[model samples]
Target: MASSSTPSVRDHASGRLKRAASTLAEDTQSLVSEIKKAFTMVKNIAVDLEREKESTKVKELETLAVQLSESCDNCIRHASAIHTVGNEYQPTSELTDFKKLLDEQFMKLKAMPSQNDRLIRQFQEAVWNVHHKGQPMPGEEEEDIVMTSTQSNLLNVKCPLSGKMITDLAEPVRSMDCKHIYEKEAVIAYLPRNGNKKQCCIAGCPKFLQAHRLVCDPFLLTEIDELRSMNQQTEQAQNVEDFTGLDDED
Candidate 1:
């Protein structure tokens, strides 16, 4: 005797499962930070008694935290697979083959490196639609809005104010208003010239540069790291080529 509210309860449970998975993922990533804090406390205790800091213990704790974090990540993946199936799909003998195939595909997805970006985006859009109903979900870009040239390429971009390259070391940040990037220190120094909010340094740019609009460009930092790796590889190749050329001359 199933009640009329059974479907509603199932839907609610699905939402809760998704939320719990998200929270668990966040907590797992933060575990390293918590370990660092605990080690700091341990060091403080050692200082009080004038004893040597337990560096070896700290390393063991960090290793344990990393292993636990990996386990939690696997748990999140399993939970996500269950949430994706929903409550409507009942396992029957007729659907056994289909269920097996579905599970295999999920396992493959778990092993895929790009699964994080693709699956997370899909799940976020699905969750937004489920909760928001009639409202349109925000996307990467809008149809009506035109992106500026600065927004097109984030790599090796220059700070408009200082005429210097913006990299991770420069503390790069992006403007939420114009999607333009800047060296964080340069932008901060430029803003006070015209009383808090200054016009963007790029010529003909209409957006005002304010402290609140500038957010840390994490993607830019990642790109910078990749670029540095590429440059190092190129330099090594050139050195090898030069050495080979000298040997040929001999």
Candidate 2:
């Protein structure tokens, strides 16, 4: 009976060992799954950080591009104005600095897009305004007898041949050549007529008598000649109207 009890105790001990081994296997599997989940989380965080870094870089580049473009535009405009003035009045020390600034800005702008048109147009207008504004009035220069501020100011004034005043003087006197002068206000009124070419209204002025002085104002004379030719052609056509009533004898 004692031998029989020993065998039963051994069997129970073996069964308990088996159950512990199964529990160990399950814990090992759980540990492996947890490690995999942690690795996945770390990978996702790394990816997000990379994307954020790239997005920040793009924004910075965009800002830099805009600043570069504006700087270039301003440089071009300033340089053009300075160059125009320099051409007419000789270059100064300030102009040299201006040109250097313009070159630096233009080099930077060349890296940007869509700046060419704006640059060209700005330069063109600046140069044109500087060169053409208040140019010599196209007409005959006459020595005028005039009184000004308690003194007689003899002026070599050029009067507009298309019946217009060139200067805005107070109480202007008319020339015998049909060049009528009034206050400067009169000149403003005459600007629209004949595209601002002041016409000489003097009766004996060659402008009205002979078409020579009339044609002196290039743009105005062109329009006047066109209108005259059109009138002549229309009158000739009207005179050629057919009179078939006398053909009844045929």
Least well predicted 10-residue stretch by lDDT in candidate 1: 143-152
Q: Quick one: best lDDT, which candidate?
A: 1
RMSD of each: 21.1, 43.5
**Per-residue accuracy of model 1 over 1-250 as CA lDDT, tens digit each:** 3676776776676566545544544454355345334534543443333323454554454444444444434544543344334322343324245466448645954774422232233233333444453355565454312231012234236787777766434577777567678888888887775558888887778988887567543233433544454456458768999999999999
Can you write out model 2's per-residue Cα lDDT over 1-250, one digit (the tens) per residue? 9777876775665455434433443343344344334433433443344345554543444344344444444443333333322222322223245456446544543453433333232222223334343232234122211111112111213344333333323333332234333333344454454454444443444532212112111112222323344356456645654444445545
Work out the TM-score per prediction: 0.35, 0.20
Q: Which regions of candidate 1 deviate over 4 angstroms?
A: 1-156, 168-170, 193-196, 203-207
Relative to the unseen true structure, what is the C-alpha lDDT of residue 223 in candidate 1, on a scale of 0 to 100? 39
